[model samples]
Target: MEKHLNIPISADEIRDLKVGESVLLSGIMITGRDAVHKWIHDTFIDKTKPATQEDLDTLSQLKPILDGGLIYHCGPVVSGLETKQYRFVAAGPTTSIREEPYQGDVIHFLNLRGVIGKGGMGPKTLKACHDAPAVYFHAIGGAAALIAESVTEVIGVHKLEFGIPEAIWVIKVKDLPVIVTMDSHNASLHTSVRDQSKSILNRLIEG
Candidate 1:
């Protein structure tokens, strides 16, 4: 099925999605990657260290935005950085499997409805999607420049000390195309493909 969705997607809306569905998303989503994921896990989920005032402040700002919202695993190439008029030159997705350790917890903690990235996540994230009633939206990997066209505006950014790539960028998008590769029903296209490939390889070897 093809659907057009807006950010701050409801849990019910996310639950309706299924693997292999195409979607065009509009509205706000925050960009996060490895450093942001690790920080969120360590500071918020695991509680390995006490959150600083800055951390708390950032969380306070993000909580409402992320509640029933999407997080994109993107490290965009940006321009006009010094002027603070940021524009995404290329906003492509990064590998999502690296976030496997933190994604599940992050989804639950943030009340996230979706995760957008390239490639796919693992069993942990799949289980999280089932439990949290979330979904994983797969973005195209090589179409960085093309994807940037969807980013209508840069609302703001946080944790600039993490550098441009790792900072959490809040953006508004229009008609951002994605495919549901993992769904709240515990379906994962990635797992299916992997298993099918393995089966094929085994059959060839046996023959």
Candidate 2:
């Protein structure tokens, strides 16, 4: 069945998704990469003067922008800097496994319901998805320009100090295609494929 998921999707909606299911997502999603993730993790971890309240307040303000929000692992090529108007030229998924160390904590802290990225995350993120009622959507690789077509507008940005590629870009999308590779129910198509492939290889070796 085809599912069209709206941004800020409710926990119930996410929980209902199954691995290998295709979804056309619309609404707002934030783009973040390695630097952004690290910054978020570092900012929240500083016990001495950690500005957690400030960060939480920022997310609070953004919550309405996307209720069941999605975080995208991407570094987009943006144009129109002279006019201070940003246009997405290309936006593609980054390797999700690179953020595995901090993804779980970020998802929990930010109350994010979905993640769009390439490759699959590890046990920590998988466990976090189940506990936080979140899911992982795998975007098509080598489809940067194609994916950018879905980005209707750039709403806002955070942490520009990290540079454009690493900054958190708030973008509105329409009918962006993705696959539910990992679901809130702790089901993972990535893991299933890997295990199945391994088993097949073992059988061939034995034969």
Candidate 3:
């Protein structure tokens, strides 16, 4: 049987992936943005506080949680207690490019193999896709309620100090279907469509 992970995979698997294949991701996905990225690198990577080697391992391996996985460009809603098993309200995509600065480093460091979002990522992330063989998956934007269903569980959270909208959340999900908007071969649908449109426009003008 094909092993389909539920959601939020692990760091190691993300590094080893292909261009056009589907996966059912499972495990814990950490939600964050520019602020959270800065926070993680500064605090977690730098060991701002004392942490055991195992803790550091988990921290660095964060992105692979989505390896052969999905990355929601979302900032989720925190409507429950901070206990171990609290489910949040709605989690959806935030602009992915804001992560450009750290996405490459994060993917490189954690072996990120996939990402899902509304507006796709930027150049650095694109290069990372080439270097890392990752794919940028596009999820249905504005479908917060539907998206929530894919999330089977909320394992917990981290760095709540960054606060909501920019915190590192541990979210678990399953059987999430997304489109391959970008691929490891450095192919981009957005650019392809744009070029096709431009060609059609020029042809019409010449005729």
Give the winner by lDDT. Answer: 1
lDDT of 2 by residue, 21-139 (tens): 99999988889889877877787644333666757776566656645688899999999867769999999899999999999988888788978999988889999999998999999
Residues 95-174 of candidate 3 have per-residue lDDT tens digits of 78777777776666555666777677777888888887677767667777777777878776666666776766777777
Candidate 1 stretches greater than 4 Å from native: none
Error of 2 at 83 (Å): 1.7
In order of appearance, the predictions have TM-scores of: 0.97, 0.89, 0.73
lDDT of each: 0.95, 0.87, 0.66
Worst 10 residues of 2 by lDDT: 45-54
Comparing 1 and 3 on lDDT, the stronger one = 1
Ranking 1 against 2 by TM-score, winner: 1
In lDDT terms, how accurate is model 2?
Answer: 0.87
Tell me the tens digit of each residue's lDDT in model 1 across 3-93. 9999889888998999999999999999999999999999988999899999999999999999999999999999999999999999999
Best model number under TM-score: 1
